[model samples]
Target chain A: MYSYSEFDEAFVRERVSQFRAQVERRIDGSLTEDEFKPLRLMNGLYLQLHAYMLRVAIPYGTLAPHQMRQLAMIAERWDKGYGHFTTRQNIQFNWPKLKDVPDILDALADVEMHAIQTSGNTIRNVTADHFAGAAADEIADPRPVAELLRQWSTDHPEFQFLPRKFKIAITGSPNDRAVTKAHDIGLRMVRNEAGEEGFEVIVGGGLGRTPMIGKVIREFLPREDLLPYVEAIVSVWNLLGRRDNKFKARIKITVHEHGIEEIRRLVEDRFTEIRPGFSGVDQEVLAGLEAAFARPSLPERSLGGFESAYTNDPVFRAWSDTNVAEHAVPGYGIVTISLKAHGKTPGDASADQMRLMADLAEELGHSEIRISHEQNVILPHVHKSDLPRVHAALKEAGLGTANVGLASDIIACPGMDYCALATARSIPIAQEIAERVDELKIEHEVGHLKIKISGCINACGHHHVGHIGILGLDRAGVENYQITLGGDGTESASIGERAGPGFSADQIVPAIERLILAYLDLRESDSETFIQSYRRLGPAPFKAALYPETAEKERADAA
Target chain B: MSRKFTPKVVTGNALIEGDAVWLTEDDRWTREMSEAELIEDEAHAQMRLLFGQSQPSVVVGVYLADAKAGLNGPEPTHFREDFRTRGPSNYPHGKQATA
Candidate 1:
């Protein structure tokens, strides 16, 4: 994990002091709500449906045990004894008094953390692969680059107030766990023809009212030119991108309106103008950041004990099967702690649980923990020998869920329950659906299904990329949900198609059950997963299952 | 109607571990106070000053009220007594309590 340099520490401390004064001003009535809203948003504070929420950024999802413990302390002290981990790999305290937020930021700064850029139109936290440094197939670790970007983008004077919020994601490997292709700017490390590592830069991809898969503006950008090129792309967008309509303000909408070729031409022109300014200073800075991310040395050990433990313990075997993944190191494995326990609220961890995770991270695994964009925690460098003990500890702490990529692991936004913008309840609906799927005992058979729920068109839950997407809406003062099928979140990402009609909150669970059973019945064989069947057969069969009456009417017309 | 309001202590979720409270009488805080006293009527006045005016009235008690109802309705105050009475703060009251 990367430790904060003295400069970084001083910068955050200054920012905290600045915000404390701003809070005091707001309370004194010198700054009105209109004047105070933007300042609070810049610091990741929001007045939601019920209470104030303070979102703290876990930069690139990386955390030291002490940082994790600090988060637990915050929850215990200022919140409702728990924190909700968000899909963006950040944690949100759903309850905090306006007066105490400054104190919270101060406490976070003590641990070298802050909520800066976690919200607002500035470049939000730069996300990367959860298994970045540890993935066996990785060409290089992406976190060093992510950390470098974090340093450069933090309160960049020019880009602080973009037309809309910007997101950037990087991946070290081609497997694309970070969903790089679906971000404002996606950087994937790749090798050129000369066998030198560089980046394949993609721009304009995002999910919102308008969902777009990013277009590749540069096939391969040399590593040294990363910052200059990014500056060129953002500058081009800032000057030329539409500011007329809020809905059409994102770079994706600009790319859609002007066409990718034109956008590419503009970016190329901008890049040429700025390429001369690229100095060796960026390379030296990146080198320093890379040194900070030096991998932990593995102890000399054999995996014979791990093999025996897995064979003897069924629970450990199940966890190892689902949660453990191949590590870059021979004797180590990356362990994912699934927050989606069946029938419970997804992505919520009690203060006690957070403390327990911190202790376990220090004791059984490496002293580093990672939060995934999927809202799970990763003990990125656990030895194979420690798997059984870790699994036992996790089970006791209610964090040992054996569903990592499975169906019950749903990603939902803070819907009507918390978000004022939300039309219906997203979290409880996701909870109910997971509970139903568990009761049916068909999640294993369903196999790697992603069911995402968004409470509104804002699409914070990323419903557009789920195998089965549930969109909650308000209809005649009642909560209604719409279902979509065949959405994917991978190298081959696609927007899902909506099925027939929307169902009321009470009717949505059975509707989803019907859709799943229909897939089961129409599947070529049990070997085929829901996504495969949906893709191969298209929405016709799923639509038929959802609205048999419509299908019958169509058949009768054809007859 | 003019009614005398008693002094009480207001408590909320603590910063570190124990509890946070403010005393209504002195407009100061003492670490020592029972949870029961923290739920009294005058305790709420302190809560309003600390948390904000829009905080939900979870527990309320009064020495005087509408004579027809005999302490049934809430005690009269300078602010409106209607169910939909607005809070004093420019920002909505109780917005910070949820966080």
Candidate 2:
């Protein structure tokens, strides 16, 4: 984990102080709502459905144990005893008084965390693969580059107010764990023909009302040219991005309207202008950042009770199969602590749960903790020998679900339940789906399915990328849900196409059950996953399952 | 043909606590929609909205919410307004805890 320098520390302190003054001004009626709105948004405050929500950035989803403890403390004291981890790898406190927010920010600054740039039309937090350094398949850690971008984008005067909120994601692995393709700028660290590490820069990819898979503008941008090149892309976007319409203000929209070729030309031109100004200063900074991310050392140990535990304990075996991933180190394993326990709200962690995770991370694993985009916590380097104990601890804390990539591990945003922008409720729907699947006891049997739900068209839950995507909408003041099939959020990413019409909230869970059951029947083999089966057979069967009567009528009409 | 305007209430979040509050006929903030002043007329609704907006120290994001006259006082017509009156569905926090 990267520690904040004196400059970084001072910067955060200054921002907190500034926000404190702004809050005072707003309270005293010196600043109007218009004046205070952008100020509050810049500091990651939002006037949500029930209260003012504060979104605090966990930079690149990485946090030290001490920092995690501070977050727990904040949740206990300031929030309603819990915090929500968002798909963007940030924690959202749904209820925070406007008066207490400044003090809350002061608390955050103490732990080198702040709400700055987590919202509004600014460069949001730079996210990376949760398994960045620890994944066995990774070429290199993407954190150093992510950290560099974080440092660069923070209070960058030139790009403070873009046409729309911009997001960037980077992944170090060939298999994209981070949803890099669904970002305004996606950086995949790739080794060139000469074995020199570089980024395959993908641009204009976003998910909202309009979804687009990012196009690779630069197949291999040298390590040195990264800062300037990225700056160039954003610069081009800032200039040409639509300002007349808020809906079409994203870089994706700009890329779409102007075409990638024209955008590339503009970016290359801007790159030429900005390249000389950097003059290796960023490279020098990156060298220090790379040095700061020290690899954890693990002593050689015997397999010991691991094999025995796997064989003897069925519960432990089930958990280990789903929750554990292969670590870069031989004896080490990456453990994903499921927040999606059966019938609970997705991404919500109680203060006690947060503290428990913090304690476990410090004691068993390294003091490092990562918040994944999938709304789960990652213990990136836990020893395989310690698996049983860790599993036991998680189970005791109600954190053990053994459903990492299963049908029940659903990703849902705080829709109408807490979000002012939400047209319909997402949390309850997600809970219903998970509980229904768990009740049926077919989650593991279904296997490797992603069910992402968004309350509105914003796609905050990355519903566009879910294999079974459910989008909740308000039709004539009633809740309606539309399902999309065959969406993926990996190296082979595809936007899910909608199955015609929609179901009521009451009808949604059963509809999903029917779809999954239909998938089981249509699949060529048990080994074939839901997405694989859908790809093999196409959306015809799934669409038929969603609306059997319509399909039957259409069949009869055809006959 | 244009649709007729529905019954409404002046609603906003409290400036300090940030909890959802409705503007009452007595010119006060109330957590319950039942206590809210139901403005059936468009002009009266606008006036109440203006009144709510004026008190920057009292409330924020002041706007008219769709509502209806009930046996009690005023009731929310939309699910969103009803949600605001109570709280989030997942947890018994916010207004739901105290109410």
Candidate 3:
């Protein structure tokens, strides 16, 4: 993790003081609500349905344990004793008082984190693969590149007020855990034909009312040219993007309206013009950023305790099987502590749990904690010798739901329950599904599933990419859930197809239950996942499972 | 003839605390939806909403929400408003947390 330089610290402190004065001006009645709205949003404060929500940026999903502890402190002091980790790799404090926001900003500055660029039509947090540095398949850590992008994009004057919000995700590995395909700009580190590492630049991918898989603007951009090339893409979109309609303002729509080839041509033209402005200073910054990320390496360690725990303890073995991912280091493993405990709110970590994780990260892990886009916390570089201890601590803290990629590990956005834009509640629906899945004890058996729920069509929960996507809507004043099938968010990203008529709030859980059970029966073997089964046989079987009543009516009609 | 207007109440989130609040007939912002002034006429609802919006320092994002005459005062018709009456269903932290 990169510690903030004196300059960086000064910049953040200045921003905080400016926001504090702005907040004071608003409270003192000098600034109108309309005037204060943008200022507050610029500081990542939003008046949500039930309360004021403060979104704090977690750059590249990486957190030093001390930073994590500071976050815990903020949650305990000013928030509702908990923080919700969003799908965008940010933490939102839901119950922040307006008067306390400036204090919160000041506190965040203390830890070199800020809420800047979290909202407004600006470049938001730059997220990366949670397992970036530790993943066995990664060629290099993507955080340095992500950090460089973060620095370049933060408060950049020319691009601050673009047509709409922009997001960028980067990953080091070919297997895209960063959901690169679903971002406005996705950068995947790849090796060129010459065996030199470069980036496969993807642009215009987003999910909302309109879901798009980002187009490959640059198939293989040289490592040194990343900053300039990315700048060109955003610059092209800033000028050409539609400002008329909010829905059509995203770069994804721009790409859709203007062909990718034409867009690429414009980007190349812009790259030529602006490439000189960089003057290789970005390279110097990137080199310094890379060195800052050179944390103590995960040296090989004895795995005897780990092996014995795996063999002897069924509980530990189950958790290890579900939550652990292979690390690049010989004896280390990446542990994703599932926040999606069955029947509990997904992605929410209590202040105590956050503190515990911070302490555990310092003690057992390499003092590094990562917040995954899946809403789980990651100890990306934990030695196998420490896995049992880490798991034990997490288990004791009620953070030991061993369902990382399983059916019960669902991603649900804060629907009508908290969001003003939500048409219906999504949390209860997510809760019911997870509870049923756990009650059946077939989550592990049902195997590798991505169940995502969105409160609305905004798809903040990444519902468009789930194998079982549940979209909550309001119909005739009643809550309705529409299911989408066969959506994926990996290297092979595709928008999910809507299954059929929406189910009522009462019927949705049962509908999802039927769908999962059907997948279990339809699958060829345990190895076949829900997505694999769906792709192999198509939506017919899943639709039949989701709408058994309609399927029966159709059968009668055919008969 | 114009269609009869449904009952409505002026609502906004408290500026300082950000709690969901409804305007009472006595010109007070109350967190309790049951204490809200449910306007039967469309003109009264619009006026009440304007008044709510006027209190910029007291509230933010004022609007009229569909309401109905309840045993006490006003009851929300839409689920969104109903959710605001209570807090998020995921946890017991909102008004319903203790209720």
Candidate 4:
């Protein structure tokens, strides 16, 4: 994990003090709600239905055990003894009072964590592959670059007030676990013909009302030019991106309206103008940041023991089959801590669980944890020797869910529950669906499914990219959920197609069950996943299953 | 019937557990008493005294329906019983008390 330097410490301390003063002024009536709202939002504090919600950034989803423990303390001391981990890989406390937020922030600063860019239109939390350093297929670890981008974009004067929130994601591997393609800027580390590591830059990807996959603006951007190139792209978007309508304010809409070619041209032009200005100082700064991210030394161990352990322990084998990933280093595995328990809220982690993860990280794995863009926690560099102990601790804490990349591990936003803009309750829906799927134990049979739920059209849940996406909407004051199928969140990312008319909140789970059964029937072979079958048969069969009566009615009407 | 609004309190584990209260007349935090009790309560004096130091602290009471009514409603749901019970339609609110 990247430890904070003196400068980083000073910056957070200063921010906390500043926010404390602001809170005092707001309470004294010196600042109006209108004036204080932006300030509070900048600090990741949101006024929700009953109380205030504070979202803390776990930058690029990385956390130290100490930081995780600090978070647990915050939840225990100031929140509901539980924290909601969000789709962005951030943790949110739903009940912090206005007076207590500054204190909470100070506590976070003590652990080298702060909520500076967690909210606001300014570049939000920089997300990356949860399995970054450990993934066997990684070309290069993306964290160093993510860290560099975080520092550069944090309070950057030019990007302080963009038309809308900007999100950036990076991936070290071709597998795309980070959902990089659905962000404003997606950077995938790639190797050139000369074997020089660089980035394959994709731009304009987003998933609000108008979902889009990023277009490749640059095929191969040299590592040195990363920051300048990013600056150029953002500057171009800021200059030309729509501001007249909030709906069309994102860079994705800008790319759509102007076309990728024009946007690429503009970015290239801007890049040419800015590249000269980035002096050797930038390179020095990046190198300094890179040094901070140097991988922790691993003690060599035998793989023979790990193989034997897996064979001997069925539980361990089951866990390894689903939750563990191949590591770049021998005898090491990337372990994911699934937050999606059967009937529990999708990403809600109790205070005790947080502390347990922190303790486990420090004891068994490296004292580091990474939050996945999928809303799960990761112990990126766990040794095979520590697997059983880690799994045992995780199981005790209710974090040992062996359903990674399966149907039960659904990504959801805190829809109608906490968000002022949600149409229906997303977390509960996600919970119900996950629980239902778990009961069926057909997740493996369903295969690699990505189910996402957004409360509304904003698509914060990335519902648009789910293999089976559910968008919760309000229909005539009733909670209604609209289902979409054939969506994917991988290298070949595609937006889902709406199956039929929406289902009532109660009808949604049963409707999903029907859809899954339909997939099984339509599948060419047992090996064919939901996405594969859906792709092969197209949306017609699924649509027919979803609205058999409607289809029949339409046919009769046509006849 | 109009939309049902859900009443909620803002207190979390950060505050004293029982301090959670429903918003009453003039932004006062009142215990979850009935409408009749709310009308006749003398505790308002003490609450006013306590909350006076905090500006913009008045917790205005509205019907549940008023509070749950969303963006496109006749008026934004504010302290409406109907709205409180039903929750906001377009966005997530009212499903959980904290939200």
Q: Please compute DockQ, using alpha carbons, for every candidate against the native two-chain complex.
A: 0.04, 0.84, 0.85, 0.11
State candidate 1's DockQ.
0.04
Q: What are the RMSD figures for all models against the true structure?
A: 8.6, 1.1, 1.1, 5.7
lDDT of 1 by residue, A236-284 (tens): 8888777778888899988888988998888888889988886788789
Residue A34 error, candidate 3, Å? 0.4
Q: Is the docking of candidate 3 incorrect, acceptable, medium or high quality?
A: high
Q: What does DockQ come to for candidate 3?
A: 0.85
Better of 2 and 3 by DockQ: 3
Q: Which candidate number has the best lDDT?
A: 2
User: What number of backbone clashes does candidate 1 have, counting pairs of residues 3 or more apart or in separate chains?
Assistant: 6
Error of 1 at A124 (Å): 0.9
Name every residue pair that clashes in candidate 2. Answer: none
> Can you write out model 3's per-residue Cα lDDT over A214-271, one digit (the tens) per residue?
8998889999999889989988999998999888999999999899999999999999
Per-model lDDT: 0.79, 0.92, 0.91, 0.80
Each candidate's B-chain TM-score, in sequence, is 0.24, 0.91, 0.95, 0.23
Q: What is the TM-score of chain A alone in each candidate?
A: 0.98, 0.99, 0.99, 0.97
Off by over 4 Å in 4: A551-559, B1-55, B59-99
Please write out the lDDT profile of model 4 over residues A441-535, one tens digit for every residue: 88877777788999899898989899899999988778889998888878989989887789998899988888888888888888888889888
Interface RMSD of each: 12.9, 0.9, 0.8, 7.3
Candidate 4's error at A144, in angstroms? 0.5
TM-score for each candidate, following the candidate numbering: 0.85, 0.99, 0.99, 0.88
